[model samples]
Target: MSDIARELNLNPSEELDLLTKWLGRESTEHVRRIRSVHVANPALGLQLVWERLEESYGSPEVIERALFVRLENFPKFSNKDPQKLRELGDLLTELNSAKSEGYLPGLSYLDTTRGVNPIVEKLPYSLQEKWLAKGSQYKEQHYVSFPPFAYFTDFICGEARRRNDPSFSLTPTPSKTSIQYPKYEQPERAMRNVKRHISTHKTDVDVNRWTSQSDCSSFKPDDIGKQCPIHQKPHPLKKCRGFRSKPLEERKAFLKENGICFKCCSSTTHLAKNCKVALKCSECDSEDHVAALHPGPPPWGTENKNSPSQYGGEGEGPGSAVTSRCTEVCSRGQSFRSCSKICLVKVYPKAHPDRATNVYILLDDQSNRSLARSEFFDLFQIKGSHSPYTLRTCAGVTETSGRRATGFIAESLDGKMNVMLPTLIECNHMPDNRSEIPTPEVAQHHGHLKSIAHMIPCLDPDAQILVLLGRDVLQVHKVREQRNGPHSAPYAQRLDLGWVVVGNVCLGSAHKPTTVATYRTSVLENGRPSLLTPCPNQLQVKERFSSKIQNATSLRSVRHDSSVFDDCNLGNTIFQSTKDDDQISSSTAPKQSGTSTQ
Candidate 1:
């Protein structure tokens, strides 16, 4: 017996379990070997195995073994018999269901059999149509003629619809199957319309004569009997056909009469190409040359009464003449006409003279104040020292004449001179009828603090520090409010002594608080003011300095002339300054009041 039979004990349940486990692990090769050994009597061999299975297990087990044996041998005969192939497919479907349900013995036995063709060829007509249209295997294997396939597909689709839903009915009952011919109304209408238009526009003109194949000259010169198509009358000339070919000479003459060519300036002849008079240039050896072509004057040379030489005059060298000579004036003693009456003289000193005068003192008191406040001059330890800086100022006014008038001035900054003007800041207050105190947040609001922060950069590039000395309108309002309230101190006393820091610079309050410090002063003014007084104590400085303001000012006015003195405010100073020693010196400076002449 087999090892599985030997392992089974006398107990039926244990024996059956052992046999089942042995069968589950059986290899396909062993099954094939058994088949080969009984190849002469395959049916007998299968019955013997079934009988053995029945004795060891039961009828159901015997039936299953028989099925497995038949499946194993089915592949061997499937190519010969379509019925066996179909049977094998049915057996595989059962095996697949059993395997899915965890019946391992059936799975093992079924696995030994190669499956039959899985294609469902014998499906119902409706199913076949659907499978042929949409199934992947059917698509790969099947082909059908257009008419038969389409007709059958439509019929099967109709049947499938009825089967899927009994209530579904064919509209007006399905027609008998037949080939469909498409109606072409659009093409028919287009043809009819084209024919109607052509017929409506038809004329009696002879197309053959209009597009005659005869040479143009072959037509008779005077054929008055021939009628003109345009006039519908006989030709004007005795034998002319009305259509006349223009003579070549006349065409050439017309071109020449209009000055179309340089050579042969005649109205009735061809141009130089056919004239034979125009010659090629001897110098450039080019055929494009026309008669009387003259070389013009050089672009940069001054025009003279005498004609320019054919070889180009001596002044007209190979390159530009203007660039070879000095055409620009120096920075001094050059005068510009401002108007019909007044002229502005440009100051250009002869080269760099010895330090004759201090240019720093020449700037206005406001400029001095700005210079004193600037950290660059302080960092260089050059405060109060005369530094040569460039000062540029631009001024404009809109007069009653409705025109914008402008003026500009540029000067070297020397300490002795001052470009002065009145301070633009003015303090004004209007009375109020009601009183209310503004919270700090409300005071800090951007709109309320307009005057302090709204100052704009001046038009002059040299005016480094643009100062708007306007009264704080917000503070004025607050003061009036305080005065109206009962049991309060004076409006001036009630005013806040706060200053706002915008970016790196601080803007001081303009009014309400009567006492305030200058940007360069550490102590409050205490209602004591001087027009051009130096700060007693150094400024209460901050960590960040406004480099944009400083650099713009430096490039504009300070660095125009190179000098040891000009190095005073040449670099960034805000983040570099450390102590009091790096502050501008305290010295009362003179004041002047006038706009810089620009």
Candidate 2:
């Protein structure tokens, strides 16, 4: 069934514009006439124009092919009067609106008639009975049933009665008479065919194995198992039947003889008790031994030894493997390795308004916060307080107490939309090659993007990405309109900044990279993101130490007091200061002993 419930709000002219703009050099007579109509009156509804042209030019399949578009208009009806038809259209429109807005649940195959029945009951009694009778006839005739919306649409189109005919039903007809066929006596032909199929299947399996082996060539010889451990055969140790057949005691002996860890069963570097690798016996939930060497009794309701329950249910236990987090000041030459959505925008620095330049801004909806290069801060001399943040990326978690700069203003090239950025965390620089950045020349190469190619700016080799806008600044990246083509083809999306081309725009091997790279960065803490905040005590201590260091470094010359004559001058000064304070206190204690005598 067609997706008739999908809402199409574009007017007739806009639809024609979409067809002509992206179809590119494939305008036929039917499309030309449609275009003429669109140019004449751009405010007409879609149904009105389709009604005029659909009869003269059947279906306009050429335009659909050129644009790669599918338009499922409400099916037409005959015999039914205009009033009831309009009411049905309104009801369908309401149902579609509710479904699109998520107020009503979508139709599923298990019971397609559930949500739609109540809506149909709101119609006239005669229409309801007619619909129900058609549904009963349909249920009796066809094994497969249309979705409720599609069924209603088919009924309106008068296909309901015709569909119940035997010719239209998919179910097989009952035989009127018995018939028989002679069987082949020779079994050799059947055996030969089966053998041929098996050989072909084996050849395909061999090819797949070769491909997997070639891709996994980077794996260590021991890890991939170049030779079986038990018999030294050219196969993985797990596939060695001799080792697997060995008794538990003998297996333990073999492990000790080979100096392999009992827990991991593969590692020879450490003993079982000292091994840090996270593994547990599947049979016993024991972390002490490998699953292969399981002893007799099956223990039920036993908790894993490495479970968090063993450590007060707070966090991962000591034996549990963890991704260690560390702070990085700046990361250079980190390849994005994939097609990136980028837009050109002007950034105005609060301190140096004259230094505003067009910067390539990467839009990542996966990221929750925005980031800018550390060098960008230095370029504008933008100063901000330190804010500690934990960044999680495809590589691993990284901790940074980086500066968060504010007072930066960004605007589209057209100057239509402007955003005052409150904060931008200092992250890292773009890769050196920057091959992932889409250029106008490459986008224009594809026919689909020819019309909008001028909207994309020319490649600026010297331009570096200064800011990466994440979901926090999603308003700037909201799609106003878009033009697209078939699968794997480049498409252009119009954002507030302007049109940006994304997808596999490269057509030749010369432009394609040797490897595929992908990276996603997000802020995560306990499976959720936490805010970046500065530590007050740490900031105060840092400020005091920095001030002292600045003062010490500024001194032009140093001299020791000649009268002191102490080798350890710094220590002696501290000691003498204490001694002088003691003497002053002793001298100031006026006649306290004499007063006590009275």
TM-score of 2: 0.30
lDDT of 1 at 541: 48
Q: 477-505 in candidate 2: lDDT tens per residue?
A: 78898888988666788888877777655
> Candidate 1 clash total?
37
| Winner by TM-score | 2
| Deviation in Å, model 2, residue 246 alpha carbon | 69
Per-candidate TM-score against the hidden true structure = 0.12, 0.30
Per-residue accuracy of model 1 over 1-598 as CA lDDT, tens digit each: 3455447534333433334446634432344444556667655554455455545555456556766675556443422233443453455556555555663454443222122212223333444554445433233324422222233333334333444443643335333321111121122222221222111232342221232222112213122124332122343311111121123343333323222333422211233466555456443545554212212211243433332222111222354433211111111122210100000111112332221221111112222222222322322232242333333222211121111111211122222221222222111111110111122221222333333322211122112221211132222112211212112111111222222211101112211322222222222345433334656685664333233345443422433333423344534442232335468866655554853432
Write down the lDDT of every candidate, Cα atoms only.
Answer: 0.30, 0.53
